[model samples]
Target: MTAEPPLLALPLHAAAPTGAPAARSFTTQLPGDPRALYLSRVWVRRIVTVLCWRGDVLRAVEAVTRLVDNGVRHGIPSSVPPPEQQLTLSIATDDTGSLIIDVADLNPAFPDFEAAVSGERGCGLWQVASLGARVTRFLPHEGRGKTVRAVLAPGPVGL
Candidate 1:
C-alpha cells in the first residue's frame, strides 16, 4: 500500500487584546504531537490564571485537556491515507464577565454532538457542555476543516 504524505504543519500564534479586560488568543497546529498537547495545557492554565479565574481551576484545566485530547484522538487521520491536520484554541473574556474558550481542529467529518453524548466513544464535548457552556461547530471559509467552539461564564457573583 502507498504511504500517505506527512501531515502538513499548521502555524501557531498568540495575541492579547490591548484594552481593559483584555483577552488572550492562541492558535496551534495538531499533528498528533505530545509536546503540542502539553504546551496547550500550559498555555491554557496561564490564560486562566491571567484572567483571574477564581473558581475551579482544576475543572478548567480538565476541560482544556479533554478538548486537546479529543482533537488529537478524533481529529487526526489514522486510516488508509492520513491527512494533514491541525487544531487551535482561543480564549477571551468579555466586558460582561464571561469567559469564552474556543477549541478548533481540522476534521472534515462533522461530529455528532448528540451521538457523542449518548455513545461512550465521545464525551469530551459532553463534559464541556455540562459545565453550562455553549458549543458550536462550523466549517472554515477557506479550508477543508471544521471548528468546534465552547463558551463558559465565570462563577457566580461574590466568588
Candidate 2:
C-alpha cells in the first residue's frame, strides 16, 4: 500500500498578552446551497485552529454548522434573484475576548426564534446555547435580512 501523507502542522499564533484583547475578524459569502453547510464547518474549524483561542473549537464548529444550515434552509428564498441567494458568515473577537459567530442571510423572517431558543423548535439552536453560547439575532440597518449571532465565552465552558 502507498504510504499516507504526513500530517501537516498548523503554525503557532502568538497569544495575546493577558488583559490585551486581540481584535480580528474573518468573513465569507456562501451561496444558498446545502453544500455550503460543509464549507461553514470547515471555515470555523480552520479559523479556530489558526487563532488558537482557548474556547473549544468543536463547540464553535457545531454551532456554526447549525447556523449555516438554518440560513441555507430558511433564509434563502426560492423567489429571490440569484445574486441575493447567498449568505454571509463572520467570526470575530470582541473587546472582552469572547468569540462571536454571525451568519446573515436574505430572509428577514425568523418566527421560530423563541421556540428555537427554548428548545421547542428543532433547529439545533438550543444545542448551541447548551454549549454555553449566547445566541441572538438582529436585522441589519438596510433591513434586507437578519443576522443570527452566537457569542462564546472566552475559554472552554463548565470551568
Candidate 3:
C-alpha cells in the first residue's frame, strides 16, 4: 500500500463564535508521521484560541501533542495498510468551556497511564496527566481503534 496522505488542521476561526460555548466538536483525519505531531499541536492551539482561552493555549498544545504523538508512535503499526493506518482526532468543549481532545488510531494498545505513571517523571503520558487537565478516561472503541481523551477547563483555571 501507499504512505498515507497528510492532514492539515482546519482554519482556527472556523470554530464557533468567540463568546459562544466552545462545545462544538471538530474531527480531522491524520496520517502517521512526525509532522502529524506538530500539526496536531497547532490544531489544539488554534481551537483554544478561538474559544477566547488564550491562557490554556500553550498547555493544551503540549498536552495534545503528547497524546497525538503517542498515537502516531504506538497506536499504528507500520505493517498496516495505508488506509487502515489512519488516525482520527476529535476536539470539543463542554458547556463550561472545558476543552476535550481525543485521538484515535487502529491499534488497540492504548496508552496505559497507570503503567506509564509508575512514578516516572519522563513519561509522556505522565506529562499529559500533569497538565492540570481533568482526564476522563481512555476508551477503546468496539473493534478498530482506541481513543485517549483529556479535558482542560476554561480560563484562569487550566494552567
Which structure among the candidates has the greatest lDDT?
Answer: 2
Q: What is the lDDT of residue 157 in candidate 3?
A: 48
lDDT of 3 by residue, 23-140 (tens): 5666777777666776676666666665565346878888888878878888887779876676777777757767777777777664455666443534777777777765544445
Candidate 2, after superposition: displacement of residue 148 in Å?
0.3
* Candidate 3 Cα outliers beyond 4 Å, as residue runs: 1-22, 117-122, 140-143, 156-159
RMSD of 2: 7.5
lDDT of 1 by residue, 56-125 (tens): 6666666667777877777666642444455667666656556666566667685566666444456788
Ranking by TM-score: 2, 3, 1
Model 2, C-alpha of 97: deviation from truth (Å): 1.9
**Per-residue alpha-carbon lDDT of model 2 for 23-122, expressed as tens digits?**
7766777778886787777777877766566788888998888888889888988889877688888777656777878888888899979799779988
Worst 10 residues of 3 by lDDT: 11-20
For model 3 the local lDDT of residue 74 reads 83
For candidate 1, the lDDT comes to 0.58
The lowest-lDDT stretch of 10 consecutive residues in candidate 1 is 9-18
Q: Candidate 1: where are CA atoms >4 Å away?
A: 1-24, 29-31, 53-55, 78-84, 117-121, 156-159
* Per-model TM values vs. the true structure: 0.68, 0.80, 0.73
